[model samples]
Target: MASNPYEVEHGIKPSAPRQTRRPDMSSFHSALHELLPEPSSSSSNRNVGPTPDALRSLFTLVLDQMTALRNQAPAGVDTELLQGLIEELVVDREHPDMKGFLTQDDLDALDRVPKKQLKQGELCPICTEAFLDDPYPLVVVLPCSDERIDPATGLTIHVKHEKHRFDLECVGPWLLSKGSCPMCRQDVNAEKKRKEIGNQERKKANAVDDEDEQDIVDGLYG
Candidate 1:
């Protein structure tokens, strides 16, 4: 009979503790007779806590957010909502009453967010680079007759590419492939109607020409 592998492994060593106990910190204390050391040069300057790299990173984050918001800002976002968001980002997040909390949060939030290409003619706040990327990721704005408007700036947002509207499933790709509007998603129908109307007009013109030719033929014969 062969020894069971599981039992042999377990028998070779005792199982590790599932829950280790924490150390007691009750006796921990600073030396009462010794004078406290002076704060380090780096730690002394509160305003100097942020390194050049950190500052640059922070600036980039602000710029990126601003650019994203601006690109998303279309023709119909509410002023109050924009104002509130701006205030929160600029006043509360950048310069908070609680200190490091806001700065840390801003960096974390911005870093986690995915980068979106701004719309045509839009500028990125971070790099100050004009948005020239094709297929811009534009969110729809509100308060317009159109459901697609910038939520932040209340401006009309145009999605970068006509094909993206179809890609987003807002409209069919075939319709957008021909550069049809994405809003109503009725581009195919419109194209079909246009073709039908054009064919009818052409048929009418041809019929008139045929009748004229028949008249001329009849007159010449008679």
Candidate 2:
């Protein structure tokens, strides 16, 4: 008797092909079927449609990347032009653009903010006034409501509130004195003052040297 392949090694024939039946498509499905054109040089002349969401997605991605980069960046860099603009706003009172903004109410408020005097006690370095206002001076209240008068100067350093803190007394006179901090001596006009003082010292030193030389000449002659 011939040995059966199925009974041989592994119990299966390696060359056997599995048979499958194809599903029959109904007439309705056959009528609905449509053929897509294969690419050819002639067919390639037709315009290709872009994916609908592609441009929008690309724009959104770019915007997101820009936002992330902006979040990662440090504070802004300074520019001389911007500095000049700020200086014009604060110091150049005569700048023509500034005239229209100063109305009577604004001027009154500016004037009413009160001159800060260096009192013996209770002076806020910020407002230069005694903190008579319960919480603090109106200006000191700005940047926070907790602004209080300095115990020594009677002015608002903390524990009060106001809109402006440019101590007119300190700033005004200091600006008059070549734009420097009156109390701390931070020179805004640094170059000008340095040059002035240097020249003055140089002149004094030269005078002293001249006096010493004349004294030596007189001693030699004697």
Candidate 3:
């Protein structure tokens, strides 16, 4: 939301909420609770602690959501950033290094998960339909996987098996965000810089080529 790491790592806040939609889990409620369980709700001063299983579940939940978001991403959104974020999350959860806790790059990398494809007659994550009763229907296969985290390490070390495809039209708009995927909690900005760098490189290359061609033409004509 701060658009980059300088803002995120420095604890810079966004001017306004990014989502005008319901269910913003990016804040303390989901972010903190997912990592650590809330204190005892029943007792005003009682302290409840987070369990290892809760940590596992939270990471697992994030992973599953990411996988779903990635698999269901539309044509417009690419899985590059989300996929990268997943890898980082895996590292953080596994390593448990508070000394270097989440850096800006790490924060920038973290974003939404992909969507899961529909099953035979299973409703789409979006449309809530197969759009028909077609089993083994012709579709785009958005590849996805299941992850397993090490309880001792507090991280996801590996993924297993691939999940199936999805409908493009159904999942596009969410994936079209500038930095992150939909279903993300606290996304980082990505595409803009890469795009700018690409454009600059292309311009330089084209400029050199144009100069060479112009020289050649001048020599030939002269």
Candidate 4:
């Protein structure tokens, strides 16, 4: 109510229009961010794992190492040569009449293994059965140092021969596991290595002898 009638006659405008009391939206704006946070560099928002860039770097390093190893790795010709010789030995042993395969194994000893069937009393220790009464029964040969009668000298001679034979099935497992003769326990691998060393030594000696022989022939011609 207009208390003073005299003031109203002058029109004082009610004390600067009664300043309005606005609501405090500063706290409301702050609370909006707290409740619904913006998507940014917050730790909780990121996935926990190795980054893609890091994985790419690791893979690149592996590829480089593999490439380096491939460049430096040897061709393994010696291993391959040895394997080929072993296979050749098998082939030559099967077909002695066939020509053109180098072998250290004695073909005479191979053929010397009695083709006669095993006696009924001679039971295989592994299978505990006599040789099968079939047309073909497999017999395996292994390296051994055994004595044999010298035909010319009439004296006993110790020789490296494949005299021992066993059932194919029994010998196969035994060779793989032990690389040895089943009866004598003589290592075939050892024998093979020894033969290889001997062959190399012989080759070296022969090469030296050939050089000497050529020198003598040259001197004679000169």
The candidate maximizing TM-score is: 4
In candidate 4, list every pair of residues with a backbone clash. none
Give the lDDT ranking, best first: 4, 3, 2, 1
Give all TM-scores, in the order shown.
0.19, 0.17, 0.26, 0.34
lDDT (C-alpha, whole model) for all candidates: 0.32, 0.32, 0.40, 0.40
lDDT of 4 by residue, 1-222 (tens): 555666688876555443212112244334323322242333454223233343333223323322333333346312332233334334433433211111112222232234473555553333333444323555555556665665654544446544365555433432422345545656665555565675586578778775534233224421
Candidate 2 wrong stretches, greater than 4 Å? 1-122, 125-128, 131-166, 189-222
TM-score of 1: 0.19
- Give the alpha carbon lDDT tens digit for every residue of 70-146 in model 2: 34333652233223323433433332221111111222233244335322345444322344432323321112234
Worst 10 residues of 2 by lDDT: 98-107
* Model 4 poorest ten-residue lDDT run: 98-107
Q: Encode model 3's per-residue lDDT on 9-44: one tens digit a residue.
A: 888774573321111234423454445534342434
Report the C-alpha displacement of residue 54, candidate 1, in angstroms: 2.1
Task: Name model 1 segments beyond 4 Å from true.
Answer: 1-49, 83-98, 102-222
Clashes of each: 13, 27, 15, 0
All models, RMSD in angstroms? 26.8, 33.5, 20.8, 39.9
